[model samples]
Target chain A: MADFEIRDLRASVEGKEILKGVTLAINKGEVHAVMGPNGSGKSTLSHTLMGHPGYTVDGGEVIFKGQNVLTLEPDERARLGMFLALQYPVVVPGISMTNFLRTALNAKRGYDGKDKTKQVSPKEFRSLLKGELEVLHMDDSFLPRYINDGFSGGEKKRAEILQMAILKPEIAILDETDSGLDIDSIKFVADAVNRMRGPELGVLIITHYTRVLQFIKPDFVHVLVDGKFVLSGGPEVADRLEKTGYSEWAEADEPAVLKPEEVA
Target chain B: MATVPKVDVGTDYKEKYGFFVPEDYVFKAKRGLNPDIVNEISWMKKEPEWMTKMRLRSLEIFRKKPMPTWGADLSVIDFENIFYYLKASNKQSTSWEDLPPDIKKTYDRLGVPEAERKFLAGVSAQYESEVVYHSLQKELTAKGVIFTDTDSALRDHPDLFKEYFGTVIPPADNKFSALNTAVWSGGSFIYVPKGVRVEIPLQAYFRINAENMGQFERTLIICDEGSFVHYIEGCTAPIYTTDSLHSAVVEIIVKKDARCRYTTIQNWSTNVFNLVTKRAMAYADATMEWVDGNLGSQITMKYPSVYLMEPGAKGDVLSVAFAGKGQHQDAGGKMIHVAPNTTSTITSKSISKAGGRTSYRVHIKMYPDAKNSKSFVKCDALLLDDESRSDTYPYNDVDAENVTLGHEATVSKVSDEQLFYLMSRGITRSEAETMIVNGFIEPFTKELPLEYAVELNRLIQLEMEGSVG
Candidate 1:
């Protein structure tokens, strides 16, 4: 399929099934909102889609553009236009944000078969870093600081946006990017995401609340309950569920999300 | 006692024709340590009374003090069977062009002259017990910087050498220091004038060309007020069958607002006992950093230390040790903060493979008067397989209650998941292993110069090839 599609995808962690076979597809330029309550496999779906080592894909396929994402490494998937703004971004010490960004950017460039030249000089790198930081309203010194070290909630979310801006991935999966933000911070994050939205970009925003949708309104809404997509509808579904709650979806016994080939 | 090889190689040396020195290349002391040998060594290099007296006093201490029991066992060192001094050539050359063909070939293979021409502002090449080639930049000498060998420093500037010689670390400091004090040979003597900073680093290259030989190098560095300088030293020995002893003592003094960085990358062959004592004193607002790398050698017991003696002083030690089969690298750092507001940081990383052993033993102390002081020690060990061993024994004696001290340590083998990830990306298993190993030592490698870091990475990759399947 040319669209970003997850066909009956199921996954597990530590021998316990967490993501029951859930399926959804989004065309280019479509902004999809994955809304669900706690223990509803929302975060697990994002991680499984990115092929996180902790989450094993037991079945089904995560076909992005055309390739099976389940067959790619997380970094490889990242290079091929898939991104996960982790709910809890892992902190890798001694590796600066600027350094990590440069490496990731180069990896993507290699995947895209772009200019295979010497590294950008320090001056150019710093200039680009300054430009990106100014866009995010971040201080210049933040680039040299270890990735996500001592970052406030809002700063970390903004950092995630900055990464997305610099990387320019084809598909951006934001996991609870506005979970811990105040109204002003959430609006700022939503505005940043909206700025990144374009005809060629497919945004998959995963969240339990519809607060962020108030700014960057989604075109499609998918209800992921018990690890399977029990229901799918338009953006109004987010507003309807925000008021009615997930009680109706919780009553149904959905089939496992994983395909047989994914399970060992 | 094992005999020194007739046709020698340092340490693990073997004898094909019994013990005998090459006639063409002159100067060989009697195969023993005594007053006669000490006097012969000093007199052979030419006269300097203070140094001769210092050597005799060190010899006495070496005789009186028993072998050390705390660190890597040094009972294997046979004092009587070892030659305290061995010279490959007759005279010292201030330029590489003046060196003999045979000696020049050795330095050429080691890339000393090329390194000197490219990066270093000065060079000292010690072949056996004597300095064969020593030179300093004319501009560095014009600024009243004194850069020469230890014996020359004693001859040229006796008072300056005597003032700080035994003050920081005395011969009685340890058994090896005492031995080095007794028969100490060629090492660097560096002095930076007040307010002067040497942009390019000065380097010393030591080579041991004889077997059953003990190369005791004594170094002294003095940085005057507001001055800054960095010094680097490296050592290598040919592979042989008999054990050689390398005991070096390095003393550094950083005055008010001065900074000094001392780096050492040692890769001796398997048959060597490397026991070195390196210490530095940082005065008010001064900084001292030690970047040490240890690879190869039979058993190495080196703990470079820094003493922050005045307020606002800082000390840092970044060290990495690699131990392969038949190697025991016992290396770490010691930080003693005696003044208020002083700070120190110690980071030690080590790798062990093929049944090798690595021990990171560090001692940090904050004296009672050292209020508001802070010290952090981070030690990490990487074992390639189950057979290899790593140990972290950190002793913290913090008497100052107001001081902030943090100590963390971790030991882990390579992860299979990470390997699989790399392998699935079209990287071979060996390349994946190398990448993981490089990443593990990334913290240390990032601190080195570009070329040295690349060389070290390649060396580690080579060492890891047969270590794992």
Candidate 2:
């Protein structure tokens, strides 16, 4: 059964509707790719799922383990095992990446309030980060740098992957993480994500191109056009859409379904 | 709805610093300032004749000088209801009275051990490890460094005390200085001889100097030619004051080729009016740096200044101000370049929250004779909530065409994007803000001495705890 379900989730940015009637159901161990062009609401879906303050929920709900996750704070959603690798990660000038990650790892483990159980010791943190750093091919030098400050486009993408690898979220959304990266960097990011692929994790990779899909290999590929998924199929749909742009499916208002005939 | 918590800064202030011991003490003056009170304060200290006369003259100046209408709102201060001088014999430290449990709890959180917390509270006259302090004092004395209280200096080393007492900042410089001079009682007096360097910061000795706590404390330090010293005073704990007025005068003379750094981190009660006059003069090739951090008081109007008096002299001032609710920190620094080849840098960092307000006001000048001089100033303020406010008033007068001066000011609120990014990583909203605040003041905190930086970080934690509830 699908552990994470998006039931006709609708959202808005600055009073204008963005994600209208978007739906998805993905359980752990399965990797799903959300392919869309610019302004197709891929970012809106990811940000709304992670509870970005800029976006407001117009209707519907996001549910994980019998809880309407949209009503929860972004941090609460995160503590309940949700992650979004932002396209443009914020640049916080003085907070080092290592320090931020340690605080984040501790928070996920319920460290701050009363029950300080499973708190990540500094010793354990260094070793845990060392493994993910090796997977992302980043040196210890990256640890001291302020989060996303002065990082190159590819460096930012890899840093997001590093966070995903460290936090090891249950269901992850990669929002345009592959937009600016070159082929080699995209391949490395895919390799890192593939390594984290286990029965404990599910992923939603949102991008404008299928270059990332070629490396990450999604079990399901959905075409998001005009805020909702206008078409759904297997890997073949991505190839066809790559050849033909999103203009064909951009006018659809309701979500398209993957029929049993297509599945057969 | 998670029940939006009201953002309040320094909410633990009362619980931490507001408890008072019975104000009954021997040799205490009545609440108010007058000519007789000044004379009584001077006679109580047994000061020299010259110092006594100066105190009388300063009292007249304090009466005549009009209260300047500038910076923060000083109208709330009830001068008539303030104790001019109080020489309380050690109640918590010496007598049978025990230390307050809450203050003791704060000391424990600050990691101050059993024998030292009372001394830090300024109620203890002696430290249990007197020999340890004595050995350090012996080294300083051997190096010809005289570290004592101002009253003792006025009585014992009258000649040296008279030489530099008000030379840097005269009583007429400001009304607060005049008031401090009139009733000034206990503050550190240090004299470093030529070419000697007191490697260790003199804070250990300062904590033991129980007389450092007067409503009007006068401090004087002189670093002789080619000498060096770093003198730090005050701690993170809230000082107990029967009166709400705290006007201190700190004067220093950095002689030729000498360098001196004076560090002060004061946490007075929120009810206090902290008006301070601090100034220093650096002679030829000398360097003077004022590292100041103020975390308390209802209204604090202080601008630690430095005058570059000769060629190649430099002045550096780094100030940190945290203004919580019902507080206004109108603080900055002054760099007066008077000679050739002099340079100075003034950096101000302030954080305000919960309807608190902070203003960074700086006055910098380069004289016509100050050719080839340069000064750079930067002011940054962070507002934690929408109700908080911050302002920058910069006065840069560059007279010499050859001199270079630059000023930069930035007022920023903790951005929602920055907070969201951190919170999305599973850290709570309050914790995320705390991280951002600690980051915003990283430049200032990094400059603090190691122990001070540690204590400052812990203080940040306490402030955060108060911020959430």
Candidate 3:
């Protein structure tokens, strides 16, 4: 069964529609990539799927684990095994990474009780975090420091990936994960994301570049233009996007005033 | 990575530290202050004649002093309605078993005895108006460390108490100071011999139990030459319909080459007006540090100050304040440079939520003879909602040359981006807010002991829960 399915999902921001009927589904053990041009409602889709309060779902439903998740809060959807790697990780000045990660993990486990036995053990958590740190080529010394405080752009991306790895969600979405990264940092982040792949996990990567696909290959690629997907194909579509760019679909969703018969 | 216990804050403040034991006092004075009441307080304690004279003089000072039109509003503090004195017991004991059953139940409920036995070097507990239980580690006592309540220090170590008492903070320093001097009952008093280093911290816990009661505790600590000691104070009060007044005076003297650290974690009920005066003097090459956390009270006006008295002296103040609904927290620190080659730093952080208001008010002064002295100040404030408010009132007077002074401040509201980011990680809204707040004050909390840090985090969690919804 598919872990996530969106049926004609329509969303808006500030009374203006940004996502016009987006439809996609990701089943278990499948990697899907959504490539879109600028202003194509790419981030709107990611945030709306995660139930961001700023975005309003005007119509349609998002079915996850046999439940319509559009009515739930962001945290509720998150605990239901859906995760999103924010493109711009928030800078929390005084909280350490260990505290945030442990809290998130335990929260997913539904361990809100006072009984420590039900929660993740400190030893188990430390080992899990240490392994993820090794995968990301980061030292354990970063654990005690504040999360994303005074971190470089590349470091922020890597931290977001580390959060995804620690949560171990059933379905995870990466929003513009490779927007701005140097050569070495991109390699480290791609390698970490690739290592997190499993036969049971559903992966979705949204990006504007195909360079990241060279490391973490996608099973299916869909092109989104003007709030609607225009093309769907295999991994070769990313290569085609790199070569042809997105000018062909600048107005693909709706024909211009000059071209009346082109719509038919 | 230890799991944080669940906090029962889905309710109001009445559930935590707000339960009151029935009023049981050996001697409950009249419901007003006068010369006769002051004399009766002195006579009830059997204090020396000189102390009685000082109390009367302080009473006159209290009456003569005018209320300054500054800081948090104090017109709500009706001095005529406050019970000036309530003697819980005349028999102060060194053992908890020897205490009255009700007072013992109060301490037991607070977990004071268990905490003192396991972690602290010494402990003094004040119930209504006097310290009822006292204990010090034998090893520390053997090292010539004098650890006792302020009243006993006056009777047992009269010469030492007379020498340092009111020396750092004079009676006329402020109206609160004058009131504390006149009716001060229970506070910690410590005297460390020269060169003796007491590694563990000494603590005192005070509580106000009666309605409209006024608690004035006087604390004095003398770190002899080259000696080192850390003193901590914690306070709480029961929820009362009428306002309670808690005015305290703490004085410290760090002698030549000595070091002293004084930490206060004040968590009174919201019906109390906590006006305090705290000051310390550091001699040549000595150091003084104040770590204060104010998380309670309807109106709190306190500014812990340090004076770099001689050359090579150093001073540091790190404080945090949290003002919840219907609360106003006016808190900061003061540093005065009097000698050359002295250095001081002040860090203040405040958070206001749910129509609460917090302000950082500080005074920094440097004299002409304080040449080549350095001072740095930083104050940061956070507002959780549009209804909350924050302000900064910094007073700097500098005259010395060849000195470096730096100040930086930032006011912020919890951003939607930060909250969404944490919520997307499966943390609830209130939990995320508490986490962010805990992080904002991490610098101050990291300086505390492990157990204290955990307790503080829980307290912050309780406060943040009320802010949301």
Whole-model lDDT values for every prediction: 0.75, 0.82, 0.81
Best by DockQ: 3
Query: Tens digits of per-residue lDDT for model 3 on B215-284?
Result: 7888899999999998878733222212279898989999999999998888766777899999999999
Taking the tens digit of each residue's C-alpha lDDT, what string does model 1 give over B1-469? 1211122333332254233334353665468787877876776666557667877888888889988777677788888988777663321213445433433343334444454421121122223323432234566788888877777787788889888887888989988899888888768889999999988777664322221123787889999999999887773322222327889899999999999999888876567899999999999999999999998788999999999999999999999998888789999999999999999999999999889999998999889989999999999998988899999889999898799999999998877655544332233456556666777777887877776786676666666765311
Give per-residue CA lDDT, model 2, range B1-469, as digits (tens).
0111222224653364343223252554477777777776676566666777888899899899989799888887777887776665622433314444545556666777655666655556455466676787788888889988778787889899989999998989989999888888888899999999889888734445555766688899999999999998887766544357889999999999999999989887677788999999999999999999988788899999999999999999999999888889999899999999999999998999888889888888999999999999999999988999999999988888688888899988889899889988999988888888888878877877897887887777667666311
In the range A151-176, model 3's lDDT, one tens digit per residue, is 88888888999999999888899998
Model 1 C-alpha lDDT per residue in residues A1-264, reported as the tens digit of each score: 547888888899888898878888877788999987778888789878877677888999988867998998776787678777777765445556776677656555662223547455577667877876776678878888766779888888888887877778788899988777666777777777888788878999998777678888999998877777767889878877766677676564332222244322
- Candidate 2 vs. truth: CA RMSD? 9.8
Q: Interface RMSD for each candidate model?
A: 5.7, 0.6, 0.7
Residue-level error in angstroms, candidate 1, position B116: 7.0
Model 2 pairs whose backbones collide:
none
Q: Is model 2 an incorrect, acceptable, medium or high docking prediction?
A: medium
* Candidate 2: regions farther than 4 A off: A113-117, A250-264, B1-25, B90-131, B204-206, B467-469
DockQ, Cα level, model 3 = 0.69
| CA deviation > 4 Å runs, candidate 3 | A115-117, A250-264, B1-25, B89-135, B205-214, B235-243, B467-469
TM-score of 3: 0.87
